[model samples]
Target: MRKILTLVIIATLTLGYSSLNAQNYKFGHINSQELLNAMPDKDSAEAKIKKYAESLQEQIEQLQVEFNKKYQDYLQKRNTFTDAIREMKEKELSDMQQRAQEYQQVAEQDYQRFQAETMKPVIDKADAAIKKVAKENGFTYIFDTSSGVLLYFSDKSIDITPLVKKELGIKE
Candidate 1:
């Protein structure tokens, strides 16, 4: 009976140890920013945004120049005008300023929408590639180290940036 109890205890310990070893997970880290910067689509998106912003800026500048000209004219003629005409001119200036402000706000919203639309596909592609790479390599979890969310990771965790880049057919 003593020998049988000892064997049972040994068997239980062995199974527990093996179970613990089997629970080991494969983890990896990557810099998402690096992946984004390396993508060709990102460059095109940036160029498109830049051009759109320049066009909006040009329109704003035109509005500003018109406002300045009108203000200057008002200043020059205010001394000679009747009180009623002066009030009318001031109202016109105020309306023009309000319109310009509204246009600026609209332009900003449009730019933001455009940027989000342009980046969605690129971001989706990158995410797919990352997921594929992680699965292919048997990684249980892949963390974005560049996002500043991870406080600590062991050296044993693999850096899977190159693998993801390769999976995406990216050169660098």
Candidate 2:
């Protein structure tokens, strides 16, 4: 009876120890903002937007310069010419100004729309890539480090931002 009791206690302690050690939970964190910014495709999209905006701005500036020159010429002639010619030149200048404003508005709207369209797909792809990384790495839960809301984290080695970024083809 004494030997059986000792054996039972030993077996119970061993089973408890193994069970405690088996409770290994893996978690990961991702700096989603950093990854998104570092993506080359996002850089390319941003560059395209900037290029378009710059081109539109340059065209607008050129138009303004031409309009200013023509207006100055008209002002000089107004002093020496009939009221009809002066009014006609003023109307032309007003119409050109209006058209320039309209052009800028249209360009801004187009750029915004394009950015939204381009970003939606990029964001979706990044999300899918993150999910794939999480599943493959056996992460039970993944948190976004960029949110600034997680106040408690027990382990830093589980921060998988770099790994996820690499898997998504983002470098540096």
Candidate 3:
């Protein structure tokens, strides 16, 4: 009975020690924001969004010019207008101004949606590449330094930016 008890204890310690040794964690980190910025897809997406914004701005400017022209005309001829005409002109100007403001608000919202939609695939590609690199390289925990959520990481934390870039076929 004593010999069997000793054997059981030795077997338990050996298995426990081996399990502890097998729990070695490999930590890696990558700056995902920098990776996304470096992607060519992102550059194209930015250019497209910029062009859309410029077009929206041009439309806004046209609305402003139309408003200015009517306002100037109303100011010049206010005394010539009958009371009814004057009130109608003022209401038109007010409605035009309101429509322009609403248009601006809508344009702002559309721009935001456009930006997010255009950037989604680019972001997803970067994320997939990061994930592939992490899994292939046996990273137990891959932290995103770009998120700003990670306050500090020691020098030993691996920066896998190059690996992710390579995985994504990005030279830069």
Query: Best by TM-score, which number?
Result: 1
- Sum up the clashes in candidate 2: 0
Summed over model 3, clashes come to 0
Q: Which pairs clash in the backbone of model 1? A: none
lDDT of 1 by residue, 12-95 (tens): 999999999767889999999999999888899899989999999999999999999999999999999999999999999999
28-95: candidate 2 lDDT, tens digit per residue: 88888888887878888788778877887898899889889988888778888678877888889999
What's the TM for model 1? 0.87
- Please give, for residues 9-112, the per-residue lDDT of candidate 3 as tens digits: 99999999998976677889998899988899999999999999999999999999999999999999999999999999999999999999999999999999
Model 3 off-target regions past 4 Å?
Answer: 1-23
lDDT to native, each model: 0.94, 0.83, 0.94
Clashes of each: 0, 0, 0
| Candidate 1 wrongly placed segments (more than 4 Å) | 1-22
Candidate 1: minimum summed lDDT over ten consecutive residues — where? 20-29
